[model samples]
Target: MDAELLQRFNPEEFYRHFLADGLRPDGRQLRQSRAAELRKGALGSACGSASLRLGRSSVLAGVRAELATEEALGRVEVSVELPALAGALFREKHRALGLMSFLSNTLTELLNSPAVFDPAQLAVQKEVCWMLNVHILCLNYDGNAFDLCLLAAIAALEDTRLPALMAESGEVPRLAVAAPGSELVAEARQLALLARPLPTTFAQMPGGQWVLDPCAAEESLGASVSLCLVEGRWLVFHQGGGADAGRFLEELMPLARGEMSKLTRLLEN
Candidate 1:
């Protein structure tokens, strides 16, 4: 039987053959993650933007700033969109919506955390402030969407710059769009980030063996556990599939930390 046919017809068995030899079909060892590339400021129209490619999966994140009332100050809104063209699974509206909600909520929580970002930074004054809207779009879906999305979001935020504020007597401060060759352009400030939380995902195979950064085929076979190291703490999110979460963490923390360090260096460059 052809390899692709075998993978499609009996994925579990196909993976078992590879696992027995301590290898994955993608030519990676069990603990190896796919090569990743991150490019910041990918979109000129947005306040800030980034494009990321992890193996075959691709994601883009853009940050836009809008004026907001005191009640909405320091509020960051996140939305994730998975078009049908991204993958077959997204063609099912309900499934796509569910995933989108999960990703959006997760990102919102992380970005809003004081440990990750300071609400005070968004404050322009007492009555009004800046609200950041982060929009994430999945360009391709080979698997591991959570990791890709989070990385892209963080990179975009790091690339963001808050426009200069112009104040008139007795009026609320408003964003100033600097004209070309204007001095106001130099007044823009880079968005300050308190921390960067990088995520590493592992998928449990049929025999309870965990593989890091599973592709689409491997993901369909088992549950996945995603670990984000945030300021010396681990944030764990597990997708259902009967895997042992505790053991997965205990055995994988060292590897996850190393991956996080590499990601940090990537963002710095």
Candidate 2:
């Protein structure tokens, strides 16, 4: 179907289908997320890698560790893009660029959060720190890209294995970089994962209906609310245009919080 025609389609029928069956069109309960699958160490060259599948959606994450000698203690740059193959309809350059901008801004905030990661650990010398680069690729974006991206990034970092570091006795603050094939002798440190807890997205229909983790079709028809809460320290909540956005977020907070708590355990291993 063409983009215009797809956008013209109404979601009342789909909502009715869910109401009649007490389940979503995709056969999920109101609070249930689609099935999720996680595979770690998928990229051989990266320090850490993982592929994630959430129902029809797919995302991959890779982590690279580089030496940072610059004076800036902490610097993180996140870029997200959708390839033409990922979404046949979104092949335009402008669309891809806009998506990258959005994802980068969202991720940079987490990196800047002081509670998430320690900048001092990256220091190799008196003022040198390691630069950790994390890349998240969206293979297929059925919906809920933010939540999926965050999850994939965390999973990949958890799987990351770093190399050994040794200080050199030569002049200045010198050190030998570890070869990839060398034995694992470096002390591993945790990646800066923002204390941000779980991410739950809600799609609010015209009336009072609120759907969690809406598919692409539902998302096109209604407004969305994305909430990320980290236990007690932080909450990053965003709402997009759709009717009754105020009520939806207020009522959905507790429910979304519960789901996030459950999802956090999946990242543990």
Best by lDDT: 1
lDDT of 1 by residue, 1-269 (tens): 89899988999999899999999998999999899999999999999999999999999999999877656457788999999989998999999999999999999999899899987788776767778999999999999999999999999999999887554334754546565565552257899789898899989999898889999888889788899989999898988888655786578888898787789887888
Residue pairs of candidate 1 with colliding backbone atoms: none
Q: Give the TM-score of candidate 2.
A: 0.83
Candidate 1 overall Cα lDDT vs. reference? 0.88
Model 2 has an lDDT value of 0.70
lDDT of 2 by residue, 141-258 (tens): 7888777887887787667665567655566855555556644435556554556446788776555577788777666666777777654543545556645545645778777767
Judging by TM-score against the true structure, name the best candidate.
1
The root-mean-square deviation over C-alpha atoms between each candidate and the true structure, in angstroms, is: 2.3, 3.9
For each candidate in turn, the TM-score is: 0.93, 0.83
lDDT of candidate 1 at residue 117, scale 0 to 100: 91
lDDT (Cα, 0-100) at 155 in candidate 2: 80
Model 1 worst lDDT run, 10 consecutive residues: 166-175
Q: How many clashes in each candidate?
A: 0, 8
Q: What lDDT would each prediction earn against the true structure?
A: 0.88, 0.70
